[model samples]
Target: MKRLVGLFAALLLLVGGLASPAQAAGTLNWTAGDSITAYTSAPTTATPGATTIVFENSAATGNTTGMPHTLTFDTSTEGYNHDVSLNILANPFDANNGRHEATVTLTPGRYRYFCSIPGHSTMVGEFVVTDGPGPDPDTTPPTVTAAAAGTQDANGNYVGTATVTVTATDNTGGSGVDKVEYALDSGAFQAYTAPVAVSTAGAHTVRYRATDKSGNASTEGSLAFTVVEPAPEEDTTPPTVNHALAGTQDDDGNYVGSATATLTATDDDSGVDRIEYSLDGGAYTAYTAPVVVSTAGMHMLHYRATDKAGNTSAEKMAHFTVVPAEEPDTTPPTVVAEVDGEQNENDAYVGRATVTVTANDTESEVASIQYALDSGAWLAYTQPVVITGLGAHTVRARATDTAGNTSPEKTVTFTVVGTGSDACEVPDTRTTVVIDGDDTGVPNADTGDGCTINDLIDEYASYPNHAAFVRHVETVTAALVAGGTLTKRQQGTIVRAAARSDIGS
Candidate 1:
C-alpha cells in the first residue's frame, strides 16, 4: 500500500505540470511574395503554447521576385498580447533559402503580427490564443464596403484624381477585423491605411476585402470610378479698361462747368475684380460711380483695373478741360426796330406797312424779345409785325438777356394812304385832244365846247378856299400835259394865266 500511494502522488504531480499553459508547441506558417501590402498566407488562431513561427519568401515558396519579408510580433500597441517575442526575416537570396523560424511562448490572449518592412504597414494581422477551451469559435467574416471620392465633374468623373476609401465591420461576438486590402485595377492586392489615390486619367476599378482574426474573409467589394485631368491653370491675363467723358462742351472742345468721367472694365476669363481711378494727379480711389470734375482746369483722369487672378492692367488716362463759371452779365441787350412800306407821289405810304424788331446780346443768350404796336401793351415777338390801317402808326421793341437784363426801348413810325380812281379830278380846256392814241380836233370839255384859258379858270376854278382852287388848276394842267392835249410850255402858260386871274384869291 505504501508503493501504490507513492506512484499515484508522482502521477498527480506530472498531470499538474502538463495542465499549465504553453506546455505544448504550435507551428504557425506565414508566406509572402513580391507584394509589399500583405503576406500570401497567414495563421489567424493558435493554441496557447510554445509557438514556432515559420516565415518563407523563396522561389520554391512562390517568391519569384526575390523580395524580403518579416514576421514580427507587435509589443507596443494596446489591446493585444505583448508576452511573445518573435521576429523572422527571410528572402530568396538569403543563406537560409528564404526560410526563417522563431520560437515564443504564447499566452491566452490576442497577438498582433505584421511585416517589419518600411512600406509593408498593411501586412498587419491578429491571432487569438486560448488555454484549452473558450466560447464558440468566431467564424463570421467582416463586412467591407468601398467608396470613391474626389472632385467630380458634371458626368461624375473625377477632375484630377480619384481616392478610394475602404471600411470594414466585424460581427458581434466574432473575432475582430485583421486587415483591409484593395486591388487597384485588377493588380496585386495592397494593404490599405489612408485613402488610396489613383491619378491615372482613365476608367478604373478597385476591389477591396477585409479579413477577421478567425481567418474568415468578407465577400469582395468593388468601387468603379473615372479620373480626368485637372482644370487649366488660373487666368493670367489682366482686365481691359476704358472710359467715356460726357457733358456739354464748347466749340473749342472744353467742357462747360463740369465734366463727367465714367470708367468701364471687363475680363473674359476671370471677370473684373475692381476698377480704380485718379482725378487729375490725386491719389487712386475705387471707382464706384461717375466722377464729376467740377474744378476749372485741365484734368487727367487715370484709370486701371485688376482681375481675380492678381493680374493688373496698364494704367490709362483721359484728358479734358473744364471752363470756369462766368461773371454775372451787367450790360443789357440791344434792340432795333424798323418799318417797311411803299410810298405814293405825296410821300405817303400806299397801303399797309411791316414793322421788324431784332435783338442781340454779347455776354448772354437772348431770353425774350417783345414789341408794341402804336401804344399797345408789349407782347412777345415771334415774327414780323404788320399794320393794315390807312393811317400813321408806331412800333416799339425791347429785349431781355439770359442774365435778366432788359434792353432800352426802340421805336419806328410810318404813314399809309387810300387808293381810288377819282381821288384827284381835273378839268380840260383845249380845242383838240388825244384820247387813247386818236386825235379829236374839237373841244374836249362840255361836249365839244371850245374853251380858252380864261374859260378854264372861270368855269372850274371855284373852291371852298384859295388852296382848293389852286390845287384844281394845277391838276387840270398836269392831265392836259400827260394826254398831249397841250404842250408842256402851253400847260405852264395856262397855269400862269390862271394864277394871274386869281379866281379864288
Candidate 2:
C-alpha cells in the first residue's frame, strides 16, 4: 500500500505539467478488448520512475461494422489525476488530431490506461512505468509544411524574381526533404528544386509538398503573392461633354431657361477634377456636386473640366435651361399712353390709343392684367389696346400679382370730346414729359397737325416726327430713290411731319 501511494504521488507531479517535443508519441493498433504482457521490455518498480507511453486508435472499423470505437480517457480517478486531456473538443481553441507527443507523467506500479473515447471502456489497460521519463510517446507524424514569406514591396505590389523560402519541419525528426516536391494547383508534381518565379499579373498561390526520406509525403500548404501592373500611365487625361445633350425646347421669347447640367467627360491620365458652368454668357459658377441645377431662366450654359495635370478640358455647353411653366411678371406697371389720337369737337372727344406698358418682376411675377372701360369689360389686354370712338372713357386698371394678389384699380377719366376748330383753340399748357425715343430739345419745335405741344417732342420713330428726325429719314429716302430701299409711306410721312413743324413753330 505504501509503494502504491508513492507511485500515485509521483505520477501526479509528472502529469501535472506537460511533456517536451522530443517524446515519441502515437497510438498502438488494437482490435477489440485485450491485455498485453508488458507495455515496455524492462519495467521498474521504484517509487519515482520516468518513461513515456502512448494511446492509439486501435479498433478496426470493418467494412460493415459500426463506426470505429471512440477512445476517451478520464482523469477523474485519484491515481490517474491530470490537468487536462488532449482533445479536439474541450481544449484550447486551436485543436487538430494528428498532433503527436502530447507529453504525460507517470510512476512505477500498475497505472491505468484507458481509451479517450465514448462507449469503449472495456478496452482499458494497466501499464507499468520504469526509469527515465517513462515510455516515450511517438511524436513523429507527417510534419506538413510549405514556403516562408516572400518580399513585400513598396506601393504594395510584389517585385523582382520572387523566391519562396522552401523549408519543412517535423515534430521529433527534422524535415526529410529528399522526396519533397512541389505541385501547382492539381498538376503533376515538380521536385522541390529552386524557388519558382511568380511573374503573373494579379494574385497567385504556390503550394509545397514535402515527402520524407520515408515514402511518407506531407499534405501541401501554400504561400500567396501579388503581381500588378504599374498603375496604368497615371491617368491624366481630362473628360469631355456632349452637345446633342443640349436640352429640351422652351419659349423664353429670348433664350433658354436655367439648368444645372452635368458636362459629360472622361480622362485617360489624371482623371476629372470638376465641371464648371455659366449661363447666358454669365460668370462661370462652381459645378454641382452631383450636377444639379436650381436657378430658373433662359440662358447659355458653358461647361468645362480640369484634371490633376492642371490641364483644362475643352469648354462644352449644355444649352440647358429651367423653364417656369409660364413666364411670370409680378410688378404692377405704370400705364401710359404710347400714342393718343386726335380729339374731335365738343362731344367730349377723348381718343382711345395704345397704352404701351411693361411688367417688372422676379420669379413667376405678375400673372395677368385687368382693364375696365367706363366700368365695363374687365377685359384681358395684350400689347396694344385700341379703345375707339369715345367721348369720355373712364379707364380703370388693375394688375394681379403672380400669386393671385389683385391690386386696387387705377381709374383715369379724360375728356375725349373736343370743341370745334372755329370755337376751340388748342391749349399750349404742356408739361415737359421725358419719353424714350423722343426729341432732346427742351423748347422743342411744335408740329401743327392740330396735334398738341407734347405730341411734337414725342414723335413716332417709325412714322411722323420733328425736323431733326425727319432729316434722318430723308437720308433713308435718298437711299430709296436709288431703288425700293425705303417705302413711299415712310418718305411721305417724314416730309409731312417736317413741313407741318416748320409752319407751326
Candidate 3:
C-alpha cells in the first residue's frame, strides 16, 4: 500500500510540471448574451499611472445611464493571477444564456473571470485572460433593419409565411454567413431561425434577429423583413430616388470604408439640378457642400447641393459608387520635410538652427508656428524657433496655422560658448634681481635683475598663500645659484637675502 501511495504522488508532480502559466484553455472567452454591450469594447485602455485595473461596462442592465457593474484587477501580485466577474442578467434578475464576455489585461499568467452575482454563475458565464490583442474593431454589428412588417397575398389577406429575407454577412473570413434565425409571432425562440423555409399557406408576421461570434447584433430597424410571394409591378417610373450624389461620409453611416463617393438618383417629378461642388470648396459638409468630382467615376462630395431656392440634394445614391480619396493620397503633406536644426551635439550648445522654419504647405500656406523646450512645455508662436537663454541651450521648433493644423517636429541644434583656458603670462628673465661672483660684497636688488631686494620682499609679503610665497622664494634662490646671471659671491648674497624674512614689527 505504501509503494502505491508513493507512485501516485510522483504521478501528480509530473502532471503539474506539464501545465503552463496561461489558462489551460488557451483562450479567454468574453461575456456575451442579452445583457451585454453588443457593439462596445472590453479591456478599454486606461492611463498607466491612473489605474492598474481595467474596466468596461458591457452589461445592458447597469448600462442604461447608471447601472451598477464592478471590474478590478491585482496590480500588487506581480505574476498575473486575478479574479473577474461577468454574471450579469436580463431585467428582473434572471440568468442569461451561455454567451459570455469579460475582458481584462493579465500579467502573462493565468486569469479567471466568473460571475459572483449569486446563482447566476452556474447559468450565465465566465472568461479568461491571455497575452494577445483583443477583437477586430472593424467587425460590423449585424444590421438590424426592420423589414416591411406586413405584406398582402393572392387572397388579398394580411398574412405572413413567418419567413423574412435576412442577408447575413460574416467576417470570420471565408464563410459568408453561418446561420440565420427568426421568432414566430413572439413564439418560443429557436436556434434554427435564419434563411428559413416558412411553409404557411397564407401571410404571417415574424421577427428576425442574429449575431456574430464577436457578438455584434443586428439593429432593431433590421428586425422584421416582409414575407411575400411575389406580387405585381408597382416600383416602375424609374424608381424616383430622392437625393443622390456623393462626397464624404455623413453622421448617419459612420462606418470606415473606402473613401470614395459614388451616387445615382431619380426624380419622378423633375430632373436633378446641376451637380456643382469643390473639394476644398470652403468647408462643406458631407451633404450640403460642393466639390469638383473631377474623376468621372462615382465619388462622395457634399453628395447633395442646392438650386436657386433650396431643394435638398442627394449624393452617393448608389451605395457601390464609392470615390477613391485614398488613391489621391489626401494624407496631409509630410511634416518631416519642413523643419530644421541638425548641428552642435551638446547639452549646453545643442541645436545649430540658424533659420528653422515650417515648410510651405502643398495644399495651403504656412500658417503659424510654435516650439517646445526639452520635455518641458509647448509654446505657440509666429517665430520660426524659440531660444530662451543662448549658451548651453537645447531647443525645438513648432509650426502651425490658423486652423490649429500643426507640422511635425523639427530639430535645429545650437551650442553656447564660454571663456577658454589661458594661464597668466610671465617673463623668462628680468633685471629685477642679481648676485655677484666669489665671496664678494653684501647682497642687493641692484646686483642684477632690476628692483631692490627691499621691494621684492614687500611684494612677496602681499601673496595670499604663505606656502606659494615660500615656493617662489625658493625658485628665485635657485636661479641665482645657476650663475651666468650672477657672480658667485653675489649668488651667496642673493640666497641670504631671499631666505631672510621680516621678523617682528
Candidate that would win on TM-score: 1
lDDT of 3 by residue, 1-505 (tens): 3343233223211111122324233333233233322313343212211112223333442344322232223223444344322222222122221122333233333333333333333322222232354323435655443343235566444354443555566644211243456666657556644355554554445666656645566553234323444443342232222433344653554322344333334444334444433343335444333223444344334444344323545442333243334333222323432234443344443212233445555655556555554443555434343231223333466555434466667765444322122211222233345222222243443313333333333333444444334333433333333424345565455556444533211
Candidates ranked, most accurate by lDDT first: 1, 2, 3
Query: Considering TM-score, which of the candidate structures 1 and 3 is the better prediction for this target?
Result: 1
- lDDT tens string, model 2, 226-265? 7665445655456764433334445643223434444556
TM-score of every model versus the real structure: 0.32, 0.25, 0.19
Deviation (Å) of 455 in candidate 2: 80
Candidate 3 worst ten-residue window by lDDT: 9-18
- What would the per-residue lDDT of candidate 1 be over residues 338-400, giving only the tens digit for each residue? 777787887776645667788999999899999776555577787665553445666788999
Better of 2 and 3 by TM-score: 2
- Candidate 1 colliding pairs: none
- For each candidate, the alpha-carbon lDDT, in order, equals 0.73, 0.45, 0.38
| Predicted model with the maximum lDDT | 1
Clash count, candidate 3: 77
RMSD of 2: 26.8
Query: Residue 394 in candidate 2 has what lDDT?
Result: 56
